[model samples]
Target chain A: MDAIVVSRLTKHYGAALAVSDISFSVPAGSTLGLLGGNGAGKTTTIAMLLGLLLPTSGSIRILGHDMARDRFAALARMNFSSPYVALPHRLSVTENLRVYAHLYDVPNTERRIRELADELDLHELLDRPAGELSAGQKTRVALAKSLINRPDVLLLDEPTASLDPDTGDMVRGWLERYRAATGCTFLLASHNMAEVERLCSDVLMLKRGAIVDRGTPGELLDRYQRDGLEEVFLDIARDRRPEMVP
Target chain B: MRPALRRVWGMVYRHLALYRRSWPRLLELAYWPTFQMLIWGFTASFFAQRLGNGGAAGVGVAAMGMLLSGVLLWEVALRTQMGLAVGFLEEIWSRNLGHVFVSPLRPWELVAALIVMSVLRMLGGVLPAVLLAWALYAFDLFAPGPVVVLFIANLMVMGWSVSLGVVSLILRHGAGAEALAWTVLFGLTPFSAVFYPVAVLPAYLRPVAWALPSSHVFEGMRAVIGPDAIGPDAIGPGAILWHELAWATGLNLAWLAAACLLFAGQFKAARTRGALLSIGE
Candidate 1:
């Protein structure tokens, strides 16, 4: 069964079309990279999937439940994380996690919080306020928050955008292991090509509220005749076709 | 706990955590109510000494007591509204609304949590003032006995109704609507007749004053403070209490229902427009 299915997903802001005629699905346990430059409707898409925003027109099915008709069921099994968003600053890390745990109706909240804290290397920071954490620490805490419910599907928007190389690599590894261990499907919206290449089995490149390209990393590299995924990204971003590029 | 209640508990805990860790936040909860109480208490004392109650029975003490009661009870309206509004504003400031909404937390559950937190916040601010009234002026807010319960509950419900309306505006317009949180209740203060009787208002404005739940509450409060407390026009305490309860319940329920519908509508609009995304940004 697919963990996510979005068809004809569209969003509008007054005269502006934020996302137009987009469709895709993530197979269970698979990772799909959502690649886009700024304002490419990546956030809009994710918001709709999470039911935080309503689509202008589209249907979203998650884990066999229609999101528009019955979103709480899907929301109960799905979680999203983004470095751009944050937990309550005055709240301690443990307090924030416990709050989400209770919202998700997770049993044994203290036990669940401890397990996530240990895994995320947050034992030392558990008592500290969330606002005082470094960028990397905040990123990890956000990731921990996303997993507090053991969601079957995880959505991440620039999950490691502000982290140092070592911490970013560590988070990527943790996510990879997490997906492998739990068979949780992932939809990652990220600008880090290396991270995407390492984690996403398939990639969908969005530009101007529409998908312009999609393929595996190897396929995209071969098709664009580029040495790296970043080069391929640049080619697409610049709107240069393969035949036009030398 | 039931799942819905658990969700509400989570929201309450989130706000409580902030209050727990920040001394300034805790201080804010009590500062205004206490300040208002002290100022009004002294003013009442001055009035009681100067006016000398006009040779009426129990009128001297009632004059003194009414001021303290007015200030403390006004807080029931202020604190409850602020409790719900401030908690929501904090979520917007922290950029945590997206996280909370994306979870299984429903809108009604969030409002329920805010109501619970508002009650706590109301007590946190008003209790200190009540104690201060007793210690300094020997004025007991509960002097009217069980009728005080009806008076307080009615004022709180009306305050909660206003709170829900302000939240709806914020959800639709973002942080720009925050000033309404403080100003909206004050807008009704003239109508509430907090320090004076509604009969004192201009003939044209009396209907508008009567329309407010707080107006009825203040009128009822005057009756309980004794007929001579609010000039010559005060009704008897027992009859006014029952009348105030019925008016307060009916009007507050209607207002609450209207506010809830407005909030729900704005919430849906915000979600569709992605207004929720731009809240903190």
Candidate 2:
């Protein structure tokens, strides 16, 4: 079963088109990379899927629930994280987690919090206010929050955007383990080609509010005649469309 | 507990945690109301002494009671409105509204949580002023009897209604419209007749004053306080009190409905525009 299915989704901001008739689906337990430049509608697509933004047209179904009519049910089974968004600054990490645990209606709240703390290595930072945390620390806390409910689906936008190389690798490894352990579906939006190549089984490249191409990392590399996704991304972004071998 | 109520409680808990740890936040809640009480209290004392010098000590005491009551009760409406608006603004300021809406919590559940938070904050701010009014000046806000509860309920509903309107404006126009949250109700005060009877308004503005539920509430308060509290022309205090109360209730119902509708419409527009994720200071 597919965990997410978006059909011809279109969004416009007045006369400006933010997302234009994009369609895709992610199989249950699979990781799908959304690769794009700035204002490529990656965030807009994610927002619509999360029911935070209304689509100008088209439909979204998550875990078989239609986002327009039955979003709350689907939302209960899904969660998202972004470095750009933040938890309340005044709230401690524990308080923030406790609040989200309750919001998600997680049973055994304290036990779940402890489990996340252990997994995220947040024991030292649990008492610290969210605003005081460094960018790296905030990213971990956000990841912990996204997993608080043990969601069937998780959306991540720039999951490691600000982390140092070592910390970013650690986070990427953690995500791999978490996905393997729970078989949770992931829709990751990132400019980090290495992160996408390492984690995404398949990737969709977006440009100007539409999907320009899609394939596995290996397949895209071969098609673009490049050794890395960054080179392929540069080619696509610079409008250097290679001819199809077929 | 049901999941919906738990979600509401979760939102409430988030704000409660902010207050619990921060002394400055807690102090801010009570500071303005107390300060307003002291200013009005001293002013009322001066007027009462003037009336006593004219050999109308009874009138002076009655006037003082009315002034003090008006100050305290107006704070209820003001604080309640601010409580709800500021609670919402905190989410925006922290850039947490997207995180909140992405949760399973419904919009109505958020509204319920905010209403509960507003009442908590209103009591936190106004209760101290009530105590000080009684302690420093022999004025008991509760002296007019159980009817005071009805007055408070009406004013609180009015406060929530006004807040709903302010929140809707913010949703439509973003943070640029936030000043309305603090200043809108103050603009309405001239028409609310808080410290004076509605009859004192210019004849042409009487209908405009009567249109607001608060005017009815204050008028009812004066009628219940004494026979001539409003004026000698005041007839049948019981009838006037009940009449004003009825008007207040009806007007509040209409205002609340309109405010809810306005908020719902603007909320939908915000979603379509993707403002929820982007709106913040």
Candidate 3:
């Protein structure tokens, strides 16, 4: 079974549809990049997948568990990370990690926390309150939190958006290493085209709440006749839907 | 060791961690109730002195007793209400609600955790005030015996009921409705007869006061304490205490049931509207 499956998923905020008929699947041990511009339903899709928002219609399956019916089973093995969401501000970094570690029921929590702190270079900041961390540090903490569960399916939204280029690259590298080591599937929603190109096996591009295009990075580049994913993204953003071989 | 209990304990430990590391937070837990006790204690003393010398010794002691009990007992309700609501608001302020909901934690578990924390917070705030009342005014809120326990429990549940309703509003409308956390309980105060007897209320407002379970508790308190002050029974103690307990148990339970249903509906609506994750933001 796929790590994540979403079919005909629709979310409407009253009269306005936020995510419309979006369908996709991510095979186990592969990364799928969800690309979209402002109001393009990337966050909405993530929210639905996390069961934070109920879809107006359709379904989500994570790790073969139907989210609407068996969400806790799926949630027990899945984790989400977004820089916009945060840990409790007054708690120390280690305190924050311990809470999630307990919630996820991670065995040998102390050892796991130590490993994450060492791997993320968070050992120095572990004693500092979460509110006191710089944006870059907070991003790393969020990444560590998402990994605390050692989730089978990881969903990340704009994970490195707050970091400098060096830190962003490092985070991406760490994610690559983690995925390679654990064989966890990832659904990443990001605007960084180069990052997506570097990590994703497949890309799903959303336009106005609908999946306008989807393919492998090289395939999309070849079809759009562009040298890079950035140019192709612009083409979609500008509504210049490229001709397809069908 | 069950996973569900472990998850609930994780939430409790999370809030406790916040309380542990911050002195200001700890100070806040005891400050307001202590402040209220001091103010009311002095006011009660002043009334007792003036009226004792004014040839109405019985009226003076009764007034002092009512005021002192009113202030302390009211904390049971206030702290419980604040505990549940503020505990919820903390997640929103920290932008951690998304992280919490994404976990395997169920909504009912969240409610259970909040209620447990409310009990802890209520004790933390009220106990200090209780001690201070003893040191300063020689008034033992515990003097009412085992019935005080029931009285406290009833008030806390009533507070929880109203707190849940307030939280539901905050969930639906976001931070703009946060003031309800502090204000909603106070709105019910006049009707509760916390400072005065139900008989003091205007005839038209009397029915509204009678509907409040807290009104009965305070009235029972007056009956329990009144005879000692006046040298004659104001109301029969046995009849009033049991009657008040029965009314409070029933009314507070109904309030709690309604609040839970309201909260469930509000949570569903908020999740559907995508309001849960963005509540404080």
- lDDT scores of the candidates, listed in order: 0.89, 0.92, 0.89
lDDT for B151 (candidate 1): 85
Model 1's lDDT to the true fold?
Answer: 0.89
**Model 3 lDDT tens row, B1-281:** 78888788889989999999888877998999999999989998998999899997677877787788888898899999999999998888888999999999998888888999999999999999999999988888877677878888889989899989999999889988989988988888988989878888999999998877789888777777664544443564333468877888899888899999999999999889998788877
Model 2 TM-score (2 dp):
0.98
| Candidate 1, superposed: residue stretches over 4 Å from native | B53-57, B236-241
lDDT string for model 2 (B1-281, tens) is 89999999999999999998899989999999999999999999999899889886567777888788889999999999999998899899999999999999988899899999999999999999999988999789987778999999999999999999999999999988889989999999999999887778899999989999999999888777664543568644444478889999999999999999999999999999999999994
Model 1: pairs clashing at backbone N, Cα or C within 3 Å: none
Task: Name model 2 segments beyond 4 Å from true.
Answer: A244-246, B227-230, B235-240
Where in model 3 is the C-alpha error above 4 Å?
A: A244-246, B54-59, B228-233, B236-240
For model 1, how does the per-residue alpha-carbon lDDT over A1-246 read when each residue is reduced to its tens digit? 788899999988888999999999889999999998898889989999999899989899999999999999999999999988889998999999999999999999999989998888899999999999998999999999999999999999999988999989988999999999999999999999999999999999999999998988889988999988889888988998988879
User: Which one wins on DockQ?
Assistant: 2
Please rank every candidate by TM-score, starting with the best: 2, 1, 3
Candidate 2 per-residue C-alpha lDDT over A87-187 given as tens digits, one digit per residue, 9 for 90 to 100: 99999999999999999999999999899888888999999999999999999999999999999999999999888899899889999998999999999
For residues A108-190, write the lDDT of model 3, one tens digit per residue.
88899999988889999999999999999999999999999899999999899889999999999999999999999999999
Model-by-model DockQ, in order: 0.90, 0.91, 0.84
True contacts kept of each: 0.91, 0.90, 0.82
- On DockQ, who's better, 1 or 3? 1
Give model 3's share of reference contacts: 0.82
